[model samples]
Target: MQIYTVGGAVRDRLLGLSVKDRDHVVVGSTPEAMVALGYRPVGKDFPVFLHPESHEEYALARTERKTAKGYKGFVIHADPEVTLEQDLARRDLTINAIAEAENGQLIDPYHGLADIEARVFRHVSPAFSEDPVRILRVARFAARFTDFTLADETLTLMRQMVEEGEVDALVPERVWQELARGLMEAKPSRMFEVLRACGALQRILPELDQLFGVPQTAKYHPEVDTGLHIMLVIDYAAAQGFSLPIRFAALTHDLGKGTTPKDVLPRHIGHEERSVKLLQQVVKRMRVPNDCKDLGLVVARFHGKVHQVCEMRAATVLTFLQETDALRQPQRFKDFLSACEADARGRTGFEQQELPYFQLLLDILKLVQSVDAGAIAQAQTDPSRIKDAVFAARVHTMEQHYQFPLSQSVTGGSG
Candidate 1:
């Protein structure tokens, strides 16, 4: 049996990127033979094994046939007769179809090296249309390799797949998985752009897709387009190396703006409430994780209010903090602030501007936490009044802090 390093490991190495994991393809090897040699069986749908020593994944070279709809509808054939070229042909992109021999010889039956050098993404074969997940994968790759462009033929093929209703076949979990990964990439907007170009974005995320042409109030959003603003927000989140929840929040914070009445033109009054409702629909539809969904919900509901924090009264700010559960879950509150900061700095000419509200909120949170809630609760004669007392105490503390010299107290707050 001949083992060769394949797919991403080979592709990243050729591009001078840091390879994180290595996947191997074992040609001319059977499951029985692999077991006899000490490889542990791991794959459920295909012949895959874990190396006894390195614990890396090793799959027997195989060819697959499309047997039904969606990505799961594949018939696999793995035997001693399966060639390395045949296994390579099944990959989604030409750049990922390259393999490396044990002797350090590069195998490029599909001219993957040429495509990699040209910084382009091209389909391996006509079989690329068989898997709907490839559309997400190609879009994600565009986000990761920011400088790379999609080949015209590949884009056409992706568009054809979308038109054929391939993207709609993707499961919710799989769609979320790809979207979450794409959002974490260096330039996540590219992923959405590629999806939009291929018509897949409209199928998977119609709310986000509709935002592209929708105009926003020019004074508030210099970018003017609600969709472009969201893209800028997510890209800023990525550039800041923020966590997944923050990025997701940034992506969904403006969904309500997309549904604004054209009669209202650029104005999006009460879009925050609209955003919260739409975010819930998206969260449920995508089966988004609780952490991401929770954060997205708060950001969507209060992001507009958050942007106006500097002007809010002490009582209003305290109410906002209480409503968001920021006092109890400080980390999530910090993440919420981060998402809002991304939104603020996402506008054109605002990229490098400082967000004083971010640090201001943190300082307010610190001051609120400093309040002796236990003492205030114990002082309350009526148990029902305990929550009100604690809230009042926190608000009182914030009011007192506001009376101090701005620079003498919490670093960024205004008097």
Candidate 2:
């Protein structure tokens, strides 16, 4: 049996990129032979074994054919007679289909090496349509390799796949996995762009697609429509290398704008609250983890609350923290600020001016952190009085820096 490095590890190495994980394709091997050689069989749908000494995945080289709908409908055939070239032909992308021999000789049966050098994303074969997951994979690859562009034929095939309704057949788990990967990449805007071009965005994330053509009031958003705003925000967030929850929160923070009445003057007066509910539904449909869903909800719910809190006293900050569960996890306060920054950056002219509120919120957090732990503990006992004391302290600090009155009317007072 001969083992070779394949897929991303090989692709990244060719491009001088840091490879994350190394996967091996074992040719001329069977499950029985692998077990006899002390390899542990682990895969259920297909046969995959773990190296006895290395503990790394070593999948038997195999060929597959589409037997039904979706990605799981594949019929996998693994045999000692299957050539490595045959196995590579079934891969999704040309860049990923390239393999390396055990002696480090690179194999390029489909000219994947040329595509990689050209910084292009190309399908290995017409058989790319067999699995719906490739649609997501290509988008994710775009995100991961920001410098690469999809080949015209590849884009056409992706569009055809979307037109054929193949995207709808994909499971939520697979969709979310690709989405999470894209969000974690250094540049995710290209992912969304590819998705939009292929029409897959509307199928998987209609809430985001709804932003397209949705007009934003020119006075506040002069750059373009709400869709562009959201995309710009995602770009800025990705540029900052924000965490998964933070990046997702930034992307969906304004999703409610699509559902708001167009005739409304402000158009998005109470969108933060509405967005929280909409995001919950979207996350549920995507099958996101509970923690991520909760974080998204919290960021959406209080994303605009910082502006309202800017003029309030120290006690108001304390009450707001307690009511919103922000007090329970102090680090989340910083995360909220990061989300607000992304939101502000996504907005147009007037929206950009509102960044002061985010800065003010950050300043308030620092002020609160400066207070003695004993004082905060004492204030926590009586949640009712917490707002007043917190607001007062905040006002005292602000009076030293600005001309505005230290005290301002507090809304949602019960918190």
Candidate 3:
């Protein structure tokens, strides 16, 4: 059996990128032979093994046939007769099809090297359409390799796959997986843009797709288009090297604007409430993780309030903190603040502007966290008044910091 390093490791190495992990394709190898040689069987759908020494994955060179719908509907054939070229031919993109031999000889049967040099994303074959996940993969690759443009033919094929209903076959988990990865890329807007171009965005995320032509208040969002604003927000999140939750929050924070009445025009009055309602649908439909879903929902419902923090009274700010559970989940609260900062900086010509409220919120959360809610609870004479007393003390702490009037009632609302 001959083993060759393949896929992203080889492609990244050739492109002068740092290779994180290496995968190998074993040609002319059978499952029995691989086991005899000390490889541990791990693959459920086909013949894949883990090397005894390196623990790296070594999949037997195989060919696949589409037997049903979706990504998992494939019949695999792995045997001693399967060739390396056949395996490479089935890859999603040409650049990822190239392999490196044991002796360091580069295999370029698919002209992957040429495509890499030209910075193009070309599909390996028409078989690329068999797996609907390839569309998400291609879009994700666009986000990763920001400079690489999709080949005209490849884009056309992707569009065809969407039109044929292949994109709709994708499972919710896989959709969320690819989308989460794409959001973490350097220029995540490209992923959405590619999806939009192929009409897959409308199929998978119509709530977001509808935002493209929807206008926002140009005075606040110079970008004007709600869709463009979201793109800018996510890219800014990525630029800040923020976590996936923050990026996801940035992506969905403005969904309410897409549903705004045309009669209202640019004013998205009460869009935050609308955004929270729409976000719940997305979170449930995509089966989004709790961490991401929680953060997205918080941002969708309160990002506007976060942006208005500087002008808010101490009581309002205190209410915001309590409502977001900042005292209990400080890290999530920090993430929430970061996402709000991304939204503030996403506007056209506002990319480099400093957001004073970001630090203000953090500082306020920190100050309120110093309030000993546990101790106050222990001192409360009555059980029913415990919650109210703790809240009043916390509000008092905030009011002291901001120097609000001492005469303001404990239940006084922000005026």
Candidate number with greatest TM-score: 1
Residue 24 accuracy (lDDT) in model 2: 90
- lDDT digits (tens) for residues 1-415 of candidate 3: 8999999999999989999999999998788999999999999999889999999999999999999989999999988898889999999999999999999999989999999999999999999999999999999999999999999999999999999999999999999999999999999999999999999999999999999999877677777888998999999999999999899999999899889899998888888898999999999999999999999999898887765565566777788887988988999999998988788888888887766556767877888889999899999889899988988888888877765432223221000
In order of listing, the candidates' clash counts read 0, 12, 0
TM-score of each: 0.96, 0.86, 0.95
Order the candidate numbers by TM-score, best to worst. Answer: 1, 3, 2
Q: Which stretches of model 3 miss by more than 4 angstroms?
A: 404-415
Give a tens-digit lDDT track for model 2, residues 249-338: 888887888888978733577877778778988998999977667677887888767656656555565567665676456677677667
Off by over 4 Å in 2: 313-319, 348-415
Model 3 local distance difference test score: 0.89
Which sequence of candidate numbers ranks them by lDDT, best first?
1, 3, 2
- Considering summed lDDT, which 10 consecutive residues are worst modelled in model 3? 406-415
Q: Which should have the higher lDDT, number 2 or number 3?
A: 3
> Model 1, range 254-344, lDDT digits (tens) per residue?
8988898999978888888999999999999999999999999998988877666666778888888889999899999999989988888
